[model samples]
Structures are given as C-alpha cells and as structure tokens.
Target: MDLTVIWAFIIAFAVFAYVVMDGFDLGIGILFPTFAAGRERDRAMNSIAPVWDGNETWLVLGGGGLFAAFPLAYAVILPATYPLIIAMLLGLVFRGVAFEYRWRDPAHQKFWDMAFTGGSFVAALAQGMTLGALLQGIEVEGRAYAGSWWDWLTPYTLLTGLGTVAGYALLGSTWLIWKLDGEEQAHARKLAIRWGAATIVLMGAVSLYNISLNADYAARWLTAPEIYWVAPVPILTGIVAISMLRAILKERNSKPFWLGIALFFLGMSGLGVTIWPYAVPEALTIWDAAAPERSQIFMLVGVALTLPLIIGYTAWAYWVFRGKVADEGYH
Candidate 1:
C-alpha cells in the first residue's frame, strides 16, 4: 500500500480514538446537569478525572496528523468550517477551566457547573455540525470554500448536532452506570435508557435526512453493490444498541459501558466506509489533498515512533485509575 494511503487511515484511526476516548468523558459532562447536582455530580466528575486529559490527546493526534499529512484538505476544510471549529475550541477551553476552578472556588461551584455543562453542549454540538457539513459536502471551487460562513447550519445539520448531544449523553450515562454505585449509579441507569432511546430516534432522523440531502443516496445506500460491504453497519449497530439497552435492563454494570463504546465505534466505522478515499467527500480525494510525499513520510515515521508510547501510557493510566468511584466527589 502507498504510504499516503496508510497515513490517511492512520489519521482516521486517531480521530476515532479521540472520539472513543474523549467521547465518554464528554458524555459525562453532557449528563452533568441531571440528578447529579450534589455528591452524585462529584462522583461523576471523579469517575473521569484521572483519564479525561489523556483522552483528549487523540484530538491533538488527529488534528496534528491532518495538518502535517494533508495540509491542503486542512486549509480548505478548516477555513470553510472556521466558525464551528472556533466554537469547538472555545468550548474546550471553557470546560477545561470549569473542571479545575470548580474545585478551587467551591463557593462558585454552581457557576462552574453550568459552565461545564454549557461547554460540553457547545463543543459536542459544534463537532456534529462540522460532521454534518462535511458529510453534507463542502462547496469547493478551485479547492477553496465557496459558501457563506453559516453554510455549516442547515436543518439536517442541526438535527445531527442534537443527535450528537444525545449520543454523548448516552455514552456518559453508560459509563456512570458502570463506574458508580448506589443512587448515582441508578440515576445514570435511568438516564442511559432515556438517552439510548433518543439516540435511536436521532440516528433514524440522520439516516432519513441523508436520503434527501444526497442525490446519490438511493444509488449508494439502496442499490449499490457497495451496500453489501456496509450492510453489517446498521445490523451491528442495532445489535449494540439493543445490547446496551439489555444490559441496563438486566442491571448489569460493566457490560453497558462496553456496549455503548461498541455502538459508537460501529457508527464511526459506518461513516468511515461511506466516506473512504474522499477526505472531503465528493470533493477531494486523499491523494489530492495529501501533503508532499516527503512530509507524509516524515510524519508517518513520527507517528510510528510516538503512537506506542501513547497506547502504553493510556493503558497504564486506565489501570491505575481502575475500580468504582465513590460518591464523596473530588477532594
């Protein structure tokens, strides 16, 4: 395989890793405003505190990989989706501040709590809008953005934005159910069921909107030979979603979190299959948007050297932090 092709997939994997790692934590934040106003919230925060910073490293990996390995696509897509991207960055900043300061200024905990929840909401929403805009297809002329600033907003994209929030909440809820005990755990279980149902409906809405948004949806999804390759996506997604629901119903702890992760991975895989080879989907092929071969090779070598350390430390941290969180919150 060509090195560039390998790099493209590598970048995709990094992005997926970010979503999977940071995703549940973001979900936790999304679920913060629920029955967690007191000790429950503290327990929830403790559940993720050890691993949250580490989880976001994958975002750096993905973004840095894109800039280094596919500068052209980065230049185009970033500029086109600048507003939402900025919103995402700002939200990240906001949440990070809230995380630390809430502990420091206990008197202002309420303000910080709202900040944390609001930040997560904005970040997740912006991410979904970016995905929707990308999938909806960027208008490029001469490989440059051809649309207005708000081109990222559309009825379909907004629906996807909401879906993303629900998805993260589900992820968070399941994680809470897994890592918490007693009242906190039970509360998370209830939210998991609610968010799980919302996820299904939103996913359906996204699927339905895809048909109207894409002229080729019928050919690509309904009758294309490629459909055979992707047929397992919906089937497996349904399986995980059902399994997640089942785990919650059975009052199982650990299984629900893993099932939620499976559901997310399956959804991401489906999207990847739908948009393979085309980094910009219908506009720029990976090869076209890739950096010069020398640059790609250099970065590939760097990633190869660095990724194992990342994987190892990630494993170590999770191990060190393993076991259930107590409702005492962060001390």
Candidate 2:
C-alpha cells in the first residue's frame, strides 16, 4: 500500500478509537441524571473521572491526523460544519466546568451536574447531526459550501442525532455494568438493557432510511463483486447485537461491557469498510484530500513519538484510577 493510504488508515483508526473511547464518557455524561442518588452518581462519575480527560486526547490526535494527512478534507468539512463545531465546543466547555464546579459546592452541585449532563447531550447530538449532514454530502462548489443553515437540519440528520445519543447511552450503561457493583451494577444493567434495545431499534431505522434514500449504498455493498464480502459485515454486526441482547438478558457480571465494545467495534467496522476510499463519502477521495507527501512524512515522525507518549500517559491514568469507586466517594 502507498504511504498516503497508510496515513489515511492511521487517521481513520485514530478517529474510530476516539469514538469508541471518549464516546462512552460522553455517553456517561448524558446518562448522569438517570442514576438517581448523589452517591451513586458520584461513583458513576468517578468510574470515568480518571480517564475522561485522556479520552479527549484521541479527538485532538484524530483532528491533527486529518490536518497532516487530509488537509483539504479538514479545511472544507470544518468550515461547513462550523455551527455544529461551535455547539460541540461549547458543550465540551460546559462539561469541563460542570466537572470542576460540581465538586466544589455541595449546595449548588446539582446545577453543575445537570449542566454537565446537558452539555454532554448537546455535544453528542451536534456531532451526530454533523455526521448525518456529512453523510448527506456537502454541496461543494470547488472548495466552498453551497448550502444554507436549514440544509444542515433535515429529518435524516435529526434521526442520526438521536441514533448517536442512543449509541452513546448503550456504551455508557455498559461501562457502568463493568465498573460498578451491587445495586449500582444492577441499575447500570437495567439501563444497559433498555438502552441497548432502544439503540438497536433506532440504528436499524437509520439503516433502513439510509437504504431507502440511497439504495446505491446497499447496491454497492451487496451487489458489487468486489464488495460482496461486505455483506458479512452487517451479518457480524447482527451477531454482535444478538450477543449483546443475550448478555444483557443473562445479566452477566463481567461480559456485558466487553460485548458493548464488540458491538461498537462491529458498527465502526461496517462504516469504515463501506467508506474505505472516501474520506468525505462521495465528496472527496483520500488521495484527493491528503496533505502533501512531505508534510505527512514530516508529521509522521513527530506523531510516532507523541502518540505513544499520549497512550502511555492515558494507560497510567487508568491504572491509577483502577478498581471500583470506593464507598467514601468523590473527594
């Protein structure tokens, strides 16, 4: 494979990793209100507290990878999705502030907690909408957006927004299942069961809608000889979904979260496989979008050193925070 292709794969994997990692924390934030009591909520928060900041590092690396490997795609998509980007950034700020503020004032903590959860909800939703809009493809004339604000707010985009929320909720609930015990674990399992069911339904609907609107994707994925093997991708996704269902029903202590990871990875695989050549779907091919080769080579050397450092630090943080949140709680 070409170096450009290798770099593209690197960027895509970094993004997918971010989605799988930080994605759950965002989901946890969105589900914060569902936990009822303050102690349980605090434990839930503590479960992710150590790694949440580190999780966002992947997002930065993903964007940096895009700038280095696919500068053109980055420039165009970022500007087109500026409004949604602002919303996500504001949500990030709100979440960070809530994280800090909620711990400081026992009296006003609830407000901060709610702000964190709501901020997470907004961020996740905006990102989903941005993805949906991107899937619909930008009206790009040369290198500029040729559409209005309303174009970014369509029914399909709305469906995607909800679907992403559901996906994150599933991830969050499963994380709780893994990290908590006793009543906390039970509550998370219940949430996981409900959210998992809801996610499957919502995502199934989105898939059907995508197919109905653009049968071409199905045709490309199902009919083309070169892509005929791709059918197994969805088949595997269904198997993972079914496995999740069985795990949730059985209420396994140690396996549900792993199953959730499987589900997320399978879904991501379906997406990455289907959109292999296109960085922005039909709008821009990876080669067309890539920065200059010299730039990629230069950046790769820096990235090689930095990425491992980030990973090491993140692993250390998780290690330090390992084990269940204690009874004494967030202090």
Most accurate candidate by TM-score: 1
Q: Which pairs clash in the backbone of model 1? A: none
lDDT of 1 by residue, 1-331 (tens): 6988998889888988887788788888888888547787888999998899899999999998898888888988998899999999998888889999999999999999989988889999998888998989888899787888888888878988998989889988988888888888888999999999998889878877876777665456666587887788889989888888999999998898888878878878877766777889888999999888888778778888999999999999999888898655566
lDDT of 2 by residue, 88-134 (tens): 88998899889878888778988998898999999889988887887
Best by lDDT: 1
How many clashes in each candidate?
Answer: 0, 0
TM-score of 2: 0.95
CA error at residue 55 for candidate 2, angstroms: 0.6
> On a 0 to 100 scale, what is the lDDT of residue 31 in model 2?
90
Over the full model, what C-alpha lDDT does candidate 2 score relative to the true structure? 0.81
Q: Which residue window of length 10 is worst by lDDT in model 1? A: 215-224
- Candidate 2 residues lying further than 4 Å off, grouped into runs, are none
